[model samples]
Target: MVLKKLVRYIINKYLKDYIEQLDYEKLKLDLKNGHVCLENLHLKPEALTDLSLPVTVATGCLEKFTLIIPWKNLYSMPTKVQIDGFYMLIVPKNGK
Candidate 1:
């Protein structure tokens, strides 16, 4: 049905714009609360500041696996969403 396709297109567009601040690839929308949630979403790693390290050393670091950033920090960061009082909740994706 044409309506189905249109709805898909709208949701997809909304997702693309929403996740621009996040490094996640997948998301789901909760229509009841108008909340978009991404499981196991990774806050993008800090930009590489130096390139001198060998590839093996880079991959072996634990920071690559997990970061200790706080939940409050995420809500403070800028996002494309302009609505007032937008909120966020970050839990370990799949209890990681």
Candidate 2:
């Protein structure tokens, strides 16, 4: 009925707004050297597959390590979301 439709519409709107707010807050967090939890988001597939050889070599040369942890490994339960890149690079600060 009309009431059911209205309720559905309101729920959808609230979900959308909540997702946007989460994204904004996440952007403000210091991702550097900190792990990011992407439990309910989907990322581009290309970014997941594409690897730059030069970058890898440079990192190796500089003795820096890059770790890619699958989302499932970080989370206890399987989520409905698939991230573009399952893992995020956490670069340490110069002095740290």
Candidate 3:
């Protein structure tokens, strides 16, 4: 259940109320590669309680750690928070 704990910890720390309706088929954490992959990820629109909450909440989470999207922004989100063990690389579908 370590994976579950890890996933929950990350979600709770970053996602907050959005977790209730977050949909993803898999949570794959590769320790050796220092990456977390959330496959088939999407959010159910109806579950969102507040529209502005997501925007501000997102900034809050990003403030805490380095966010890598597209796998191309990897080198930019400040190396201080980009600790290999702390960041998550959210490689969006087809690199979109």
- The 0-to-1 C-alpha lDDT of every candidate, in the order given, reads 0.34, 0.31, 0.39
Q: List, residue by residue over 1-96, the lDDT tens digit for candidate 2.
A: 553344335434644422322232222111242322323332222222235322211111111112233444557643232234333343332351
- Candidate 1's residue-wise lDDT over 1-96, tens digit each? 553345346545644433324433443443333344444322222222244322211111111212122334557754233223223332222222
Candidate 3 segments exceeding 4 Å error: 1-4, 19-25, 46-96
**Which of the two candidates, 1 or 2, achieves a greater lDDT against the reference?**
1
Indicate the TM-score of model 3: 0.36
C-alpha RMSD of each candidate structure in angstroms: 14.1, 16.8, 12.9
Candidate 3: clashing pairs of residues: none
Query: What value of lDDT does candidate 3 attain over all alpha carbons?
Result: 0.39
Comparing 1 and 2 on TM-score, the stronger one: 1
Better of 2 and 3 by lDDT: 3
TM-score of every candidate: 0.23, 0.19, 0.36
Clashing pairs in 2: 43-84
What candidate 2 gets wrong by more than 4 Å, as runs, is 17-96
Worst 10 residues of 2 by lDDT: 56-65
Error of 1 at 43 (Å): 3.1
